[model samples]
Target: MTAVPQPTAALLDGTALARELTARTAESAAELRRRTGTAPCLATVLVGADPASVTYVRMKQNSCAKAGIESRHVALPAEISTAGLVDAVTALSEDPAVHGILLQHPVGAHIDERAAFEAIAPGKDVDGVTTASFAAMSFGLPGFVSCTPGGIMRLLDAYDVELSGRHAVVVGRSPILGKPAGMLLLARDATVTYCHSRTADLRAHLREADLVVAAVGRPRFIRGEDLKPGVVVVDAGYNEGNVGDVDFDSAAARASLITPVPGGVGPMTIAVLLEQTVEAAWRQLVS
Candidate 1:
Protein backbone atom coordinates (compact mmCIF):
# COMPACT_ATOMS: atom_id res chain seq x y z
CA MET A 1 0.00 0.00 0.00
CA THR A 2 1.24 3.47 -0.89
CA ALA A 3 1.67 5.90 1.96
CA VAL A 4 0.37 9.49 2.05
CA PRO A 5 2.83 12.28 1.25
CA GLN A 6 3.25 15.35 3.44
CA PRO A 7 0.49 17.94 3.38
CA THR A 8 0.94 21.39 1.91
CA ALA A 9 2.72 23.82 4.20
CA ALA A 10 1.10 26.91 5.64
CA LEU A 11 2.35 30.06 3.98
CA LEU A 12 4.48 32.29 6.21
CA ASP A 13 3.27 35.71 5.16
CA GLY A 14 6.30 37.94 5.55
CA THR A 15 4.36 40.87 4.21
CA ALA A 16 1.89 40.78 7.08
CA LEU A 17 4.60 40.12 9.60
CA ALA A 18 6.77 42.89 8.21
CA ARG A 19 3.86 45.28 8.36
CA GLU A 20 3.30 44.43 12.00
CA LEU A 21 6.96 44.67 12.85
CA THR A 22 7.40 47.96 11.03
CA ALA A 23 4.38 49.40 12.73
CA ARG A 24 5.93 48.62 16.08
CA THR A 25 9.24 50.09 14.97
CA ALA A 26 7.48 53.20 13.80
CA GLU A 27 5.92 53.65 17.17
CA SER A 28 9.35 53.40 18.75
CA ALA A 29 10.73 55.85 16.23
CA ALA A 30 8.02 58.33 17.10
CA GLU A 31 8.63 57.87 20.79
CA LEU A 32 12.35 58.32 20.36
CA ARG A 33 11.89 61.57 18.49
CA ARG A 34 9.44 62.86 21.08
CA ARG A 35 11.84 62.07 23.89
CA THR A 36 15.01 63.39 22.22
CA GLY A 37 13.50 66.19 20.08
CA THR A 38 15.14 64.68 16.96
CA ALA A 39 14.46 61.71 14.77
CA PRO A 40 16.81 58.77 14.63
CA CYS A 41 19.05 59.00 11.56
CA LEU A 42 20.43 56.31 9.27
CA ALA A 43 23.20 56.97 6.76
CA THR A 44 23.20 54.90 3.59
CA VAL A 45 26.51 54.73 1.72
CA LEU A 46 26.51 53.24 -1.75
CA VAL A 47 29.58 52.78 -3.95
CA GLY A 48 29.12 52.67 -7.71
CA ALA A 49 25.93 52.99 -9.76
CA ASP A 50 24.67 49.45 -9.80
CA PRO A 51 20.99 49.73 -10.71
CA ALA A 52 19.85 47.03 -8.30
CA SER A 53 21.85 48.50 -5.44
CA VAL A 54 20.36 51.90 -6.15
CA THR A 55 16.88 50.47 -5.98
CA TYR A 56 17.60 48.75 -2.68
CA VAL A 57 18.97 51.93 -1.11
CA ARG A 58 15.93 53.85 -2.27
CA MET A 59 13.66 51.29 -0.69
CA LYS A 60 15.45 51.60 2.64
CA GLN A 61 15.28 55.37 2.49
CA ASN A 62 11.58 55.25 1.76
CA SER A 63 11.03 52.90 4.66
CA CYS A 64 12.94 55.25 6.93
CA ALA A 65 10.85 58.19 5.91
CA LYS A 66 7.71 56.20 6.58
CA ALA A 67 8.93 55.34 10.07
CA GLY A 68 9.85 58.98 10.84
CA ILE A 69 13.51 58.03 10.76
CA GLU A 70 15.87 60.39 8.93
CA SER A 71 17.93 58.99 6.02
CA ARG A 72 21.15 60.39 4.62
CA HIS A 73 22.18 58.94 1.26
CA VAL A 74 25.78 59.13 0.04
CA ALA A 75 26.47 57.89 -3.46
CA LEU A 76 30.12 57.38 -4.42
CA PRO A 77 31.68 56.95 -7.84
CA ALA A 78 32.13 53.46 -9.21
CA GLU A 79 35.86 54.02 -9.58
CA ILE A 80 36.48 55.49 -6.14
CA SER A 81 39.57 54.13 -4.40
CA THR A 82 39.06 51.87 -1.38
CA ALA A 83 40.79 54.40 0.88
CA GLY A 84 38.62 57.21 -0.39
CA LEU A 85 35.45 55.20 0.17
CA VAL A 86 36.60 54.18 3.64
CA ASP A 87 37.31 57.79 4.48
CA ALA A 88 33.79 58.79 3.50
CA VAL A 89 32.20 56.04 5.60
CA THR A 90 34.43 56.81 8.58
CA ALA A 91 33.35 60.42 8.40
CA LEU A 92 29.73 59.37 8.62
CA SER A 93 30.59 57.12 11.57
CA GLU A 94 31.74 60.19 13.42
CA ASP A 95 28.73 62.29 12.46
CA PRO A 96 26.68 63.16 15.52
CA ALA A 97 23.37 63.06 13.60
CA VAL A 98 23.86 59.61 12.11
CA HIS A 99 22.61 56.81 14.33
CA GLY A 100 23.10 53.93 11.91
CA ILE A 101 25.24 53.28 8.79
CA LEU A 102 24.62 50.89 5.93
CA LEU A 103 27.28 50.37 3.27
CA GLN A 104 25.40 48.99 0.28
CA HIS A 105 27.27 45.84 -0.73
CA PRO A 106 29.26 44.68 -3.79
CA VAL A 107 30.90 48.09 -4.23
CA GLY A 108 33.13 46.78 -7.05
CA ALA A 109 35.70 44.11 -7.77
CA HIS A 110 38.49 46.65 -7.41
CA ILE A 111 37.30 47.81 -4.00
CA ASP A 112 38.10 46.03 -0.76
CA GLU A 113 34.62 45.42 0.67
CA ARG A 114 35.90 44.39 4.08
CA ALA A 115 37.89 47.55 4.52
CA ALA A 116 34.90 49.69 3.60
CA PHE A 117 32.63 47.76 5.98
CA GLU A 118 35.10 48.13 8.82
CA ALA A 119 35.15 51.86 8.32
CA ILE A 120 31.61 52.08 9.72
CA ALA A 121 31.83 52.17 13.51
CA PRO A 122 30.42 49.09 15.19
CA GLY A 123 27.84 51.17 17.06
CA LYS A 124 26.57 52.49 13.72
CA ASP A 125 26.69 49.20 11.79
CA VAL A 126 22.94 48.80 11.55
CA ASP A 127 23.24 46.55 8.52
CA GLY A 128 25.47 44.34 10.66
CA VAL A 129 28.06 43.31 8.03
CA THR A 130 31.24 43.91 10.01
CA THR A 131 33.21 41.20 11.83
CA ALA A 132 32.26 42.92 15.09
CA SER A 133 28.54 42.36 14.58
CA PHE A 134 29.15 38.81 13.36
CA ALA A 135 31.09 37.99 16.51
CA ALA A 136 28.37 39.47 18.68
CA MET A 137 25.71 37.54 16.80
CA SER A 138 27.68 34.29 17.04
CA PHE A 139 28.22 34.71 20.76
CA GLY A 140 24.62 35.85 21.46
CA LEU A 141 25.87 39.10 22.91
CA PRO A 142 24.23 42.51 22.72
CA GLY A 143 24.86 43.93 19.26
CA PHE A 144 23.15 44.58 15.95
CA VAL A 145 22.53 41.56 13.77
CA SER A 146 22.75 41.22 10.02
CA CYS A 147 19.35 42.54 8.89
CA THR A 148 18.25 39.49 6.89
CA PRO A 149 19.37 36.96 9.48
CA GLY A 150 17.83 39.00 12.27
CA GLY A 151 14.55 39.14 10.38
CA ILE A 152 14.54 35.37 9.91
CA MET A 153 14.81 34.89 13.64
CA ARG A 154 11.81 37.17 14.13
CA LEU A 155 9.77 35.08 11.70
CA LEU A 156 10.61 31.84 13.46
CA ASP A 157 9.74 33.23 16.88
CA ALA A 158 6.58 34.85 15.57
CA TYR A 159 5.38 31.49 14.39
CA ASP A 160 6.60 29.75 17.58
CA VAL A 161 8.81 27.21 15.82
CA GLU A 162 10.93 25.13 18.16
CA LEU A 163 14.65 25.88 17.76
CA SER A 164 16.36 24.17 20.64
CA GLY A 165 18.00 20.92 19.61
CA ARG A 166 16.38 21.10 16.18
CA HIS A 167 18.59 20.25 13.23
CA ALA A 168 18.93 23.33 10.99
CA VAL A 169 20.66 23.05 7.61
CA VAL A 170 21.64 26.37 6.08
CA VAL A 171 22.33 26.45 2.34
CA GLY A 172 24.71 29.26 1.53
CA ARG A 173 27.66 30.80 3.34
CA SER A 174 27.88 34.37 2.18
CA PRO A 175 29.17 36.58 5.02
CA ILE A 176 25.94 38.53 5.30
CA LEU A 177 23.34 35.82 5.23
CA GLY A 178 24.22 32.13 5.45
CA LYS A 179 27.12 32.18 7.88
CA PRO A 180 25.44 34.56 10.31
CA ALA A 181 22.17 32.64 10.01
CA GLY A 182 23.79 29.40 11.11
CA MET A 183 25.51 31.17 13.94
CA LEU A 184 22.19 32.50 15.17
CA LEU A 185 20.58 29.09 15.07
CA LEU A 186 23.55 27.55 16.80
CA ALA A 187 23.39 30.20 19.47
CA ARG A 188 19.77 29.28 20.05
CA ASP A 189 20.77 25.67 20.72
CA ALA A 190 19.96 24.31 17.30
CA THR A 191 22.20 21.70 15.74
CA VAL A 192 23.28 23.63 12.66
CA THR A 193 25.08 22.42 9.52
CA TYR A 194 26.23 24.55 6.61
CA CYS A 195 26.07 23.53 2.93
CA HIS A 196 27.84 25.71 0.47
CA SER A 197 29.26 25.61 -3.09
CA ARG A 198 31.63 22.80 -2.10
CA THR A 199 29.05 20.54 -0.52
CA ALA A 200 29.08 17.16 -2.28
CA ASP A 201 25.74 15.94 -0.92
CA LEU A 202 23.39 18.82 -0.38
CA ARG A 203 20.29 16.67 -0.42
CA ALA A 204 21.69 14.42 2.28
CA HIS A 205 21.76 17.35 4.65
CA LEU A 206 18.32 18.56 3.60
CA ARG A 207 16.80 15.19 4.39
CA GLU A 208 17.78 15.58 8.02
CA ALA A 209 17.06 19.25 8.65
CA ASP A 210 14.15 20.26 10.84
CA LEU A 211 14.58 23.72 9.42
CA VAL A 212 16.12 24.86 6.10
CA VAL A 213 17.28 28.32 5.12
CA ALA A 214 17.99 28.66 1.36
CA ALA A 215 20.18 31.69 0.82
CA VAL A 216 22.19 30.68 -2.23
CA GLY A 217 21.55 33.20 -4.99
CA ARG A 218 20.43 30.67 -7.55
CA PRO A 219 16.71 30.72 -8.30
CA ARG A 220 14.76 27.60 -7.46
CA PHE A 221 17.93 25.62 -6.76
CA ILE A 222 16.38 23.69 -3.84
CA ARG A 223 13.47 21.43 -4.72
CA GLY A 224 10.66 19.85 -2.69
CA GLU A 225 11.78 16.28 -3.12
CA ASP A 226 15.08 17.02 -1.47
CA LEU A 227 13.48 18.21 1.81
CA LYS A 228 12.31 16.04 4.62
CA PRO A 229 8.60 15.92 5.35
CA GLY A 230 7.37 18.68 7.64
CA VAL A 231 10.59 20.66 7.36
CA VAL A 232 10.30 24.40 7.90
CA VAL A 233 11.73 26.34 4.94
CA VAL A 234 12.90 29.92 4.79
CA ASP A 235 14.00 31.03 1.30
CA ALA A 236 16.11 34.13 1.75
CA GLY A 237 17.10 34.45 -1.91
CA TYR A 238 15.70 37.44 -3.80
CA ASN A 239 16.93 37.10 -7.36
CA GLU A 240 15.66 38.90 -10.41
CA GLY A 241 12.16 37.98 -11.62
CA ASN A 242 11.03 37.75 -7.96
CA VAL A 243 12.34 34.20 -7.70
CA GLY A 244 13.79 32.49 -4.62
CA ASP A 245 16.55 29.98 -3.97
CA VAL A 246 14.10 27.17 -3.17
CA ASP A 247 11.41 25.89 -5.55
CA PHE A 248 8.50 27.36 -3.62
CA ASP A 249 5.69 25.32 -5.11
CA SER A 250 7.36 21.97 -4.58
CA ALA A 251 8.90 22.81 -1.24
CA ALA A 252 5.61 24.14 0.09
CA ALA A 253 3.96 20.87 -0.73
CA ARG A 254 6.37 19.01 1.52
CA ALA A 255 7.13 21.52 4.27
CA SER A 256 5.12 22.52 7.31
CA LEU A 257 5.73 26.26 6.87
CA ILE A 258 7.62 28.38 4.32
CA THR A 259 8.30 31.98 3.40
CA PRO A 260 7.64 33.45 -0.05
CA VAL A 261 10.20 35.32 -2.11
CA PRO A 262 8.94 38.82 -2.84
CA GLY A 263 6.86 39.19 0.30
CA GLY A 264 8.83 37.11 2.74
CA VAL A 265 12.34 37.94 3.82
CA GLY A 266 12.58 41.20 1.89
CA PRO A 267 10.30 43.31 4.05
CA MET A 268 11.54 41.79 7.29
CA THR A 269 15.10 42.83 6.44
CA ILE A 270 14.15 46.47 5.97
CA ALA A 271 12.01 46.39 9.09
CA VAL A 272 14.90 45.09 11.20
CA LEU A 273 17.18 47.78 9.82
CA LEU A 274 14.70 50.47 10.74
CA GLU A 275 14.14 49.05 14.19
CA GLN A 276 17.85 48.85 14.88
CA THR A 277 18.37 52.39 13.69
CA VAL A 278 16.03 53.66 16.36
CA GLU A 279 17.67 51.50 19.01
CA ALA A 280 21.09 52.80 18.04
CA ALA A 281 19.87 56.34 18.44
CA TRP A 282 18.44 55.61 21.86
CA ARG A 283 21.63 53.88 22.99
CA GLN A 284 23.80 56.69 21.71
CA LEU A 285 21.81 59.18 23.73
CA VAL A 286 22.17 57.26 27.00
CA SER A 287 25.78 56.20 26.46
Candidate 2:
Protein backbone atom coordinates (compact mmCIF):
# COMPACT_ATOMS: atom_id res chain seq x y z
CA MET A 1 0.00 0.00 0.00
CA THR A 2 1.18 3.53 -0.90
CA ALA A 3 1.68 5.84 2.08
CA VAL A 4 0.00 9.25 2.07
CA PRO A 5 2.35 12.21 1.98
CA GLN A 6 2.46 14.30 5.12
CA PRO A 7 2.84 18.08 5.21
CA THR A 8 6.42 18.96 6.06
CA ALA A 9 5.71 22.52 7.17
CA ALA A 10 4.67 23.69 10.59
CA LEU A 11 1.44 25.73 10.59
CA LEU A 12 1.80 29.35 11.64
CA ASP A 13 -1.51 29.10 13.59
CA GLY A 14 -2.54 32.74 13.36
CA THR A 15 -5.93 32.09 14.95
CA ALA A 16 -4.33 30.98 18.21
CA LEU A 17 -1.86 33.85 18.27
CA ALA A 18 -4.54 36.39 17.42
CA ARG A 19 -6.59 35.15 20.34
CA GLU A 20 -3.68 35.72 22.71
CA LEU A 21 -3.00 39.17 21.29
CA THR A 22 -6.67 40.14 21.45
CA ALA A 23 -6.86 39.01 25.05
CA ARG A 24 -3.93 41.23 25.90
CA THR A 25 -5.60 44.09 24.01
CA ALA A 26 -8.73 43.52 26.05
CA GLU A 27 -6.70 43.85 29.22
CA SER A 28 -5.18 47.07 27.94
CA ALA A 29 -8.62 48.40 27.01
CA ALA A 30 -9.91 47.57 30.45
CA GLU A 31 -6.97 49.34 32.03
CA LEU A 32 -7.51 52.41 29.86
CA ARG A 33 -11.18 52.58 30.79
CA ARG A 34 -10.35 52.17 34.45
CA ARG A 35 -7.75 54.91 34.36
CA THR A 36 -9.39 57.45 32.03
CA GLY A 37 -13.09 56.53 32.10
CA THR A 38 -13.03 56.57 28.28
CA ALA A 39 -13.48 53.57 26.04
CA PRO A 40 -11.29 53.35 22.96
CA CYS A 41 -13.50 54.29 20.00
CA LEU A 42 -12.90 53.49 16.37
CA ALA A 43 -14.84 55.31 13.65
CA THR A 44 -15.31 53.22 10.52
CA VAL A 45 -16.35 54.89 7.26
CA LEU A 46 -17.60 52.76 4.39
CA VAL A 47 -17.94 54.53 1.04
CA GLY A 48 -19.99 51.97 -0.89
CA ALA A 49 -22.07 48.97 0.06
CA ASP A 50 -19.70 46.44 -1.41
CA PRO A 51 -20.57 43.18 0.31
CA ALA A 52 -16.97 42.22 0.97
CA SER A 53 -16.01 45.63 2.35
CA VAL A 54 -19.12 45.76 4.50
CA THR A 55 -18.35 42.31 5.81
CA TYR A 56 -14.77 43.31 6.61
CA VAL A 57 -15.91 46.43 8.47
CA ARG A 58 -18.41 44.38 10.43
CA MET A 59 -15.72 41.92 11.35
CA LYS A 60 -13.49 44.66 12.67
CA GLN A 61 -16.38 46.17 14.62
CA ASN A 62 -17.17 42.80 16.14
CA SER A 63 -13.55 42.41 17.12
CA CYS A 64 -13.67 45.81 18.80
CA ALA A 65 -16.59 44.67 20.92
CA LYS A 66 -14.69 41.57 21.96
CA ALA A 67 -11.67 43.66 22.86
CA GLY A 68 -13.68 46.13 24.96
CA ILE A 69 -13.45 48.96 22.44
CA GLU A 70 -16.26 51.21 21.16
CA SER A 71 -17.14 51.43 17.46
CA ARG A 72 -18.90 54.13 15.38
CA HIS A 73 -19.89 53.43 11.78
CA VAL A 74 -20.79 55.69 8.85
CA ALA A 75 -22.22 54.22 5.68
CA LEU A 76 -22.08 56.48 2.65
CA PRO A 77 -23.51 56.18 -0.82
CA ALA A 78 -21.48 54.72 -3.67
CA GLU A 79 -21.69 57.92 -5.70
CA ILE A 80 -20.47 60.26 -2.97
CA SER A 81 -17.86 62.71 -4.21
CA THR A 82 -14.26 62.50 -3.01
CA ALA A 83 -14.54 65.84 -1.21
CA GLY A 84 -17.67 64.69 0.58
CA LEU A 85 -15.95 61.51 1.75
CA VAL A 86 -12.95 63.49 2.90
CA ASP A 87 -15.18 65.76 4.91
CA ALA A 88 -16.73 62.76 6.61
CA VAL A 89 -13.36 61.27 7.56
CA THR A 90 -12.01 64.64 8.66
CA ALA A 91 -14.96 65.05 10.98
CA LEU A 92 -14.22 61.73 12.58
CA SER A 93 -10.52 62.52 12.79
CA GLU A 94 -11.19 65.82 14.54
CA ASP A 95 -13.63 64.34 17.00
CA PRO A 96 -12.02 63.82 20.41
CA ALA A 97 -14.33 60.92 21.12
CA VAL A 98 -13.11 59.01 18.07
CA HIS A 99 -9.75 57.47 18.87
CA GLY A 100 -9.10 55.89 15.48
CA ILE A 101 -10.38 56.30 11.91
CA LEU A 102 -10.85 53.49 9.39
CA LEU A 103 -11.85 54.33 5.83
CA GLN A 104 -12.69 51.18 3.94
CA HIS A 105 -10.89 50.73 0.61
CA PRO A 106 -12.09 50.69 -3.00
CA VAL A 107 -14.05 53.79 -2.14
CA GLY A 108 -15.66 54.13 -5.62
CA ALA A 109 -13.36 54.42 -8.61
CA HIS A 110 -14.33 58.05 -9.13
CA ILE A 111 -13.48 59.16 -5.60
CA ASP A 112 -9.94 60.15 -4.69
CA GLU A 113 -9.14 57.56 -2.02
CA ARG A 114 -5.77 59.10 -1.23
CA ALA A 115 -7.38 62.46 -0.52
CA ALA A 116 -9.84 60.84 1.84
CA PHE A 117 -7.07 58.95 3.64
CA GLU A 118 -5.09 62.13 4.09
CA ALA A 119 -8.11 63.75 5.72
CA ILE A 120 -7.67 61.41 8.68
CA ALA A 121 -5.58 62.96 11.44
CA PRO A 122 -2.20 61.28 11.60
CA GLY A 123 -2.69 60.57 15.31
CA LYS A 124 -6.02 58.87 14.71
CA ASP A 125 -4.90 56.94 11.63
CA VAL A 126 -5.05 53.57 13.34
CA ASP A 127 -5.98 51.80 10.13
CA GLY A 128 -2.65 53.01 8.77
CA VAL A 129 -3.77 53.84 5.21
CA THR A 130 -2.44 57.39 5.14
CA THR A 131 0.86 58.50 3.61
CA ALA A 132 2.02 59.48 7.08
CA SER A 133 1.44 55.96 8.28
CA PHE A 134 3.32 54.51 5.31
CA ALA A 135 6.22 56.83 6.00
CA ALA A 136 6.21 55.80 9.64
CA MET A 137 6.26 52.15 8.62
CA SER A 138 9.16 52.71 6.25
CA PHE A 139 11.10 54.72 8.82
CA GLY A 140 10.22 52.62 11.88
CA LEU A 141 8.71 55.60 13.64
CA PRO A 142 6.36 55.53 16.62
CA GLY A 143 3.11 55.27 14.69
CA PHE A 144 0.46 52.79 13.73
CA VAL A 145 1.28 50.25 11.01
CA SER A 146 -0.73 48.84 8.14
CA CYS A 147 -2.79 46.22 9.98
CA THR A 148 -2.11 43.21 7.71
CA PRO A 149 1.61 43.85 7.51
CA GLY A 150 1.73 44.45 11.23
CA GLY A 151 0.04 41.13 11.71
CA ILE A 152 2.45 39.44 9.35
CA MET A 153 5.36 40.76 11.41
CA ARG A 154 3.74 39.51 14.57
CA LEU A 155 3.25 36.11 12.94
CA LEU A 156 6.89 35.91 11.91
CA ASP A 157 8.04 36.91 15.36
CA ALA A 158 5.79 34.33 16.96
CA TYR A 159 7.40 31.65 14.80
CA ASP A 160 10.89 32.95 15.61
CA VAL A 161 11.68 33.49 11.94
CA GLU A 162 15.13 35.00 11.54
CA LEU A 163 14.59 37.80 9.05
CA SER A 164 17.91 39.59 9.13
CA GLY A 165 20.06 38.99 6.05
CA ARG A 166 17.42 36.67 4.61
CA HIS A 167 16.41 36.89 0.97
CA ALA A 168 12.71 37.79 1.16
CA VAL A 169 10.42 37.82 -1.88
CA VAL A 170 7.19 39.80 -1.74
CA VAL A 171 4.84 39.03 -4.62
CA GLY A 172 2.70 42.14 -4.72
CA ARG A 173 3.04 45.89 -4.88
CA SER A 174 -0.16 47.21 -3.38
CA PRO A 175 0.68 50.34 -1.43
CA ILE A 176 -0.94 49.18 1.79
CA LEU A 177 0.04 45.52 1.81
CA GLY A 178 2.95 44.68 -0.44
CA LYS A 179 4.99 47.88 -0.42
CA PRO A 180 4.86 48.44 3.31
CA ALA A 181 5.52 44.75 3.92
CA GLY A 182 8.71 44.95 1.89
CA MET A 183 9.72 48.17 3.61
CA LEU A 184 9.26 46.59 7.01
CA LEU A 185 11.30 43.58 5.91
CA LEU A 186 14.01 45.86 4.61
CA ALA A 187 14.04 47.81 7.86
CA ARG A 188 14.82 44.49 9.52
CA ASP A 189 17.85 44.09 7.21
CA ALA A 190 16.31 41.54 4.83
CA THR A 191 17.20 41.65 1.17
CA VAL A 192 13.78 42.15 -0.42
CA THR A 193 12.69 41.44 -4.01
CA TYR A 194 9.29 42.56 -5.33
CA CYS A 195 7.31 40.70 -7.99
CA HIS A 196 4.14 41.59 -9.87
CA SER A 197 2.15 40.62 -12.95
CA ARG A 198 4.74 42.17 -15.26
CA THR A 199 7.77 40.60 -13.61
CA ALA A 200 9.94 38.33 -15.77
CA ASP A 201 10.90 34.83 -14.64
CA LEU A 202 9.16 35.03 -11.24
CA ARG A 203 10.14 31.44 -10.42
CA ALA A 204 13.80 32.38 -10.30
CA HIS A 205 13.09 34.89 -7.55
CA LEU A 206 11.00 32.46 -5.49
CA ARG A 207 13.75 29.88 -5.51
CA GLU A 208 16.18 32.35 -3.97
CA ALA A 209 13.88 33.55 -1.19
CA ASP A 210 14.30 32.41 2.42
CA LEU A 211 10.89 33.94 3.14
CA VAL A 212 8.00 34.44 0.71
CA VAL A 213 5.09 36.79 1.35
CA ALA A 214 2.30 35.98 -1.10
CA ALA A 215 0.05 39.04 -1.27
CA VAL A 216 -0.60 38.95 -5.02
CA GLY A 217 -4.42 38.59 -4.49
CA ARG A 218 -4.72 35.79 -7.05
CA PRO A 219 -5.85 32.44 -5.66
CA ARG A 220 -3.10 29.80 -5.76
CA PHE A 221 -0.88 32.04 -7.86
CA ILE A 222 2.37 30.66 -6.34
CA ARG A 223 2.81 27.02 -6.95
CA GLY A 224 4.78 24.68 -4.65
CA GLU A 225 7.20 23.57 -7.30
CA ASP A 226 8.51 27.10 -7.74
CA LEU A 227 9.50 27.54 -4.08
CA LYS A 228 12.81 26.64 -2.46
CA PRO A 229 12.83 23.69 -0.11
CA GLY A 230 12.16 24.65 3.53
CA VAL A 231 11.23 28.27 2.70
CA VAL A 232 8.78 30.09 4.95
CA VAL A 233 5.53 31.03 3.19
CA VAL A 234 3.06 33.68 4.28
CA ASP A 235 -0.15 33.62 2.27
CA ALA A 236 -1.71 37.07 2.67
CA GLY A 237 -4.36 36.68 0.01
CA TYR A 238 -8.01 36.07 0.84
CA ASN A 239 -9.88 35.06 -2.27
CA GLU A 240 -13.30 33.50 -2.77
CA GLY A 241 -13.98 30.20 -0.98
CA ASN A 242 -11.20 30.78 1.55
CA VAL A 243 -8.38 30.46 -0.95
CA GLY A 244 -4.94 32.07 -0.64
CA ASP A 245 -2.27 33.34 -3.03
CA VAL A 246 -0.13 30.25 -2.43
CA ASP A 247 -1.17 26.70 -3.19
CA PHE A 248 -1.39 25.53 0.44
CA ASP A 249 -1.75 21.79 -0.12
CA SER A 250 1.23 21.52 -2.39
CA ALA A 251 3.36 24.18 -0.74
CA ALA A 252 2.95 22.63 2.70
CA ALA A 253 4.86 19.64 1.49
CA ARG A 254 8.00 21.71 1.01
CA ALA A 255 7.61 24.76 3.26
CA SER A 256 9.33 25.00 6.63
CA LEU A 257 6.42 27.06 7.98
CA ILE A 258 3.19 28.30 6.31
CA THR A 259 0.13 30.26 7.29
CA PRO A 260 -3.33 28.92 6.45
CA VAL A 261 -5.81 31.06 4.51
CA PRO A 262 -8.76 31.74 6.85
CA GLY A 263 -7.25 31.09 10.28
CA GLY A 264 -3.96 32.74 9.45
CA VAL A 265 -3.57 36.31 8.24
CA GLY A 266 -7.31 37.11 8.45
CA PRO A 267 -7.63 36.86 12.24
CA MET A 268 -4.32 38.62 12.88
CA THR A 269 -5.32 41.58 10.69
CA ILE A 270 -8.32 42.41 12.89
CA ALA A 271 -6.35 41.68 16.04
CA VAL A 272 -3.71 44.24 15.12
CA LEU A 273 -6.38 46.80 14.18
CA LEU A 274 -8.03 46.50 17.57
CA GLU A 275 -4.71 46.70 19.41
CA GLN A 276 -3.67 49.82 17.51
CA THR A 277 -7.04 51.46 18.11
CA VAL A 278 -6.67 50.93 21.82
CA GLU A 279 -3.12 52.26 21.71
CA ALA A 280 -4.29 55.36 19.86
CA ALA A 281 -6.95 55.91 22.49
CA TRP A 282 -4.44 55.60 25.30
CA ARG A 283 -2.11 58.07 23.66
CA GLN A 284 -4.91 60.52 23.01
CA LEU A 285 -6.56 60.30 26.42
CA VAL A 286 -3.48 60.12 28.61
CA SER A 287 -1.02 62.27 26.71
lDDT of each: 0.92, 0.93
* Candidate 2 per-residue C-alpha lDDT over 1-287 given as tens digits, one digit per residue, 9 for 90 to 100: 96544678999999999999999999999999999999999999998799999999999988999999999999999999988998899899889999999999889889988899999999998978899999988998899899999999999999999999999999999988999999999999999999999999999999998999999989999988889899999999999988999999889888999999889998999999999999999999998
Question: Considering summed lDDT, which 10 consecutive residues are worst modelled in model 2?
Answer: 2-11
Q: Clashes per prediction?
A: 0, 0
Model 1 error, position 25 (Å): 1.2
User: Evaluated with TM-score, which candidate comes out highest?
Assistant: 2
| Ten contiguous residues minimizing lDDT sum, candidate 1 | 2-11
Model 2 residue runs over 4 Å out of place are 1-6
- Candidate 1 clashes between residue pairs 3 or more apart in a chain or in different chains: none
